[model samples]
Target: MASLELKIEAKAKQLGLGPIGIIKPQAMEGYIHRLFERMLRVPNGEKLHRGFLELFDVRQAYPWAKSIVVTYADNSIYYLPNVARKHFGKFFLTDNRYNINAPARKMIASLTAFMEGLGIRTSWNEHPGVTGLRWAAQEAGLGIIRRNNFFFSRRAGSYVSLTGWVTDTDMELRSTHKEEPCPEDCSLCIEACPTGSLSAPFTMNMATCISCANSYTDSTAIDDHKLNVLTGSWLYGCDNCQDACPFNQITGYSTEIDFPGLMELDHYLYPEIIADLDYEDINDFIRPKFFYIKSESLWRWRLNAINVLINTGSSDCTRILKKLLKDPFEIVRRRAQNALELLGS
Candidate 1:
């Protein structure tokens, strides 16, 4: 009889999804404890990461899970404009998770189907209910966690989009060893972070993280710190730490597997264009692609644009802020007003 684990591995490789690894559905020793303590130690940590408490009970989150599967989607094939790269995250742009036609999506569906064919069950990655994929990757021995808290497999840099799930089947373990830690003397990622959220090695303060500041909920209110250069310039994601990492120098990104429809996103990704997006554009163009902001809260985009302009402090950025003084959302209009004043417009 063919080993189900090997067949699954072969199927994943056939779909351009390899380096797949399996492990028990638990994080490494003290990872959860260290993370929780770090988060709670910061001011307003619970408010920023309210969903994090759920990670405490893996059994409750995955009652039927027998093993955890971890895999990555390479993001090198997508072509992002320089202007877009400044304001958006590479993973969000090239992410194949929600795109039904993308190869990564196809691979995920294929694997899920293949497992179900043998009466096995599967569930998507419950990131809030589980720990970060960095721990899972390390536990599975598929990748290493950089000091910046980003995952890097040997095949790809920190640009890879992580996605996986738990399955009921007893899959074979791909690895039982861990890689060496980052250089003790190196603090490049920490030094590169503009927000100072990465104050220490491998730990992050999400409340002040540039990427975290981009997301907003109904209760999210405007804060004075938004105008600070640390969190203001880059609207959606920050790449400083990743770009500074030595391991991210992996050579094959641009020439690797292609991500479909990535170039098309260049049209609506600029800070200038995003700031003026209307309700129709929000639904048709913005939300469908970069959806960290809620549909009802498109004002956040305008606010981000204003903050970025404030950081620019250029005559052109000032002109754009003047135009935004009439934004429909009161919050956006107020933010633009303040931004223009800051720019001496």
Candidate 2:
């Protein structure tokens, strides 16, 4: 039998991963139980068992889908609005909802496909009020939670998304590890969040979070111009707190089998053009990497973008907003109209 480290190192390289690590399951036993319990404490957690079981039932897919330390790149800024704007958008700025981006979505889909192709089923869970993935990832020694309340792996920054496959293959357990201590004087993440959602270290007010808006399907409409402005340069998912963290600086880009490729931030920040994407365009060009964007809940993302662009008062965004008035997607057109009205008012 190969040593745990040797096997994991080979797997990481085969998957185009960056530096890899390991955490023994025994080391994570207590932490995983607590994390599972904590997630179950959520009101909706009771309903998640079906989903979890559905994922587990497909484990027959991959014979080699062993549990090793999975790692990705550290493109921290790519997920946030400010950093993404530099790379993707021209008219408006918003968060990089990878679910909608062509490259990112493709990567995610490919990963899922790979898992299923191996006869294993994968569950991509980001349910509200539950942190099972977080607990699992953290317990697996991928990274520790920082004061900014985001997972931070030593190799990849907070930019990595969490998704995993459970397989019939039980490989060696890597070491269970934790994040290094935070520096004494750093509070950038706390200060950068405009809505004060980072109310306390490791405790967030999801009800008041911009990211929360992207996650919910039936929450109150957050079409308020004032709230948009406070979203602080994010279009879909806000990363103000993560952007402010000093520990994230120690990270580098990912080497995962695929990272979101080729699309710019504009794809996410501008509602006027994105609403016009046909299903083929979404599936062929974008969906493989950003499957989450397909969710109808993206109305919140478009609305958030409109508010920020209007608040910037950038003339370039004016025509884009105007064009969006007749969008094929009613949600886009409605949000555009409301934004234009807010701008006029």
Candidate 3:
């Protein structure tokens, strides 16, 4: 008969996951404490600290949860082509819309169903919860925490999506201490950051991060300088740090067939497309998988499109900016006015 760990690993592989790791729920205390201390110094850190306490209390919801199983699916290579063509060739819009949470959710759902069939009880944690998934992944021997504050698996680099669950089933925990994979002197990701968000090794100022600044539902929080610093290319997510990593450059390709291929230039945002886009076009074509923004927040997307057009510095974009001057969303109109100023129109 197979051990419970072996059975779980088999089930994970069958679901198209990259790796599986296990740890005792009680063993996560040290990692949680360190994270809590770090979270205390950031903006809105108090609220985050409180949230972390609730989420990291492994025994709070499932007192019977003796063990935790951590799993990650490869994503570094999953969207490389689209990202490359977008940044280097100025081709398509490279958003993480396709492969963000969908794959991990599917894998977790399948694993839960399989575990239930074997009469084992389980509970999964969604994102923004107290699971400390990246830290938990480090403790489970799945990866190391790199200087950019992302989990780096030797096999998957920094492009892995993590999912975790607590269970009543007891499993052997892997060693918590593993040699760090990053070189002591490497600062590639840090040097690539446009906003200096990477304050130090493994430290990030979330408020200024391009990924957070652009996608944040509150468009008013970001001022003009930060918006310009986001660069004109990225629409939804930023990959400057990851793209600059030597590790990612070498091991970023995946064998997954379901991933989308390199999108053509036409698939990206252009002056013509931005001029014609409306609410229906945004809902049907622009929204990525697992859409989170509200109807009122659609202006953020429009603002991003306007920024991209401004980056082109084409006189052609002046007309589009003019059309957007009367947009109902005050935020959109303000940005269009900014674009016109940038274009000297």
Candidate 4:
């Protein structure tokens, strides 16, 4: 029988995978310690426990999937339906969601099921940190961290999700020391934050971000001005800074993991769908991965989107806004009502 390393590599290549590699478990300790040090400096280190434990096989689901590896450059391209036609010719929304549509859900389920079959368990938690995943992938010999503080695999650029697994079998790799810190001159991701959320290099101030705020459910006493600026996102999420990265721009198309496409409805198709969403509809569809939005975040996002529309002088959505005044999601409805007041003022 072929070795586990060969098996995974063969499977990936057979599927036309972009780039993949392996990392030994023992090699992960240093980066793990550094991340812990950063966590200690941050306000609440305890909150990161779930994320920390997830790096190891908290549940040894698919032991053969143990080696941390990833496919890169998943969402560098997107089609802006409203302005894309006028500015970015021939650009279309990424159809990534299509592949994983039922398949994505099924694939995740299957992976989990396979883990269970192998006596591994999976647990859901609140917002998990990306650092642990990053560390594990690094230890697994998958890739290195670039100046942008995002994973920099030769193939995927920085667009890959850092997923992990555990297997009974140990994968072989040419042991090497962890990569050194990023180059000093590379400040692309920091320069890309429109809201200045990156307080220091590699540190994200989550409270002020559009993505984080957009996921919030509470609309209490939020700045109406800021909220209006958010609604510009048509679909589920935002990627302003990532889009501006030099590495991201040059990344070839990702062929490995195929779920989160450029314009996946959950991520980029903002204005139209959100304009029509009610509480129940949101709960059913948007709340799953977008739980943050169902909270105060969606309210802020709606308000921000409205502001973006008004500022752009895009009157096409006037009717939508008028209807949004009666939305079931109180935050969205309230904010839309307020945005109307601002427009009239």
Residue-pair clashes per candidate, as listed? 0, 30, 2, 42
TM-score of each: 0.90, 0.63, 0.84, 0.67
Which parts of model 1 have CA positions greater than 4 angstroms off? 26-29, 125-131, 176-180, 217-221, 251-253, 256-258
C-alpha RMSD of candidate 2? 6.9
Q: Give the lowest summed-lDDT range of ten residues in model 3.
A: 87-96
Give the alpha carbon lDDT tens digit for every residue of 124-221 in model 2: 43221112344446666667777765667766667665544343345544445556767777677778878776655655555566666543443453
Using lDDT as the measure, the top candidate is 1
Error of 3 at 101 (Å): 11
Off by over 4 Å in 2: 1-5, 19-70, 73-83, 86-131, 169-171, 176-179, 184-186, 252-290, 295-302, 316-341
lDDT of 4 by residue, 1-345 (tens): 876556555554544443445554455567656666546645554463335544544334333443343332234332234443221111123322223542323333444454355453433221242225566655545676654456655455566544444444445543343445555776767776656665456565444555545444434325535533543442333465556566566664433433343344433345445455664555555444343454534454455456556656666667778887776567667767776786783
Candidate 3: tens digits of C-alpha lDDT, residues 88-121: 3111132223343345556778898988788888
For every candidate in turn, the CA RMSD to the true structure comes to: 2.5, 6.9, 3.9, 6.2
Clashing pairs in 1: none
Cα lDDT of candidate 4 equals: 0.49
Candidate 4 ranges beyond 4 A from true positions: 40-131, 174-182, 216-235, 252-273, 277-304, 316-319
Model 1 agreement with the true structure over 176-237: per-residue lDDT tens digits: 43445688899999999887888887678776777777755433434645424666467777
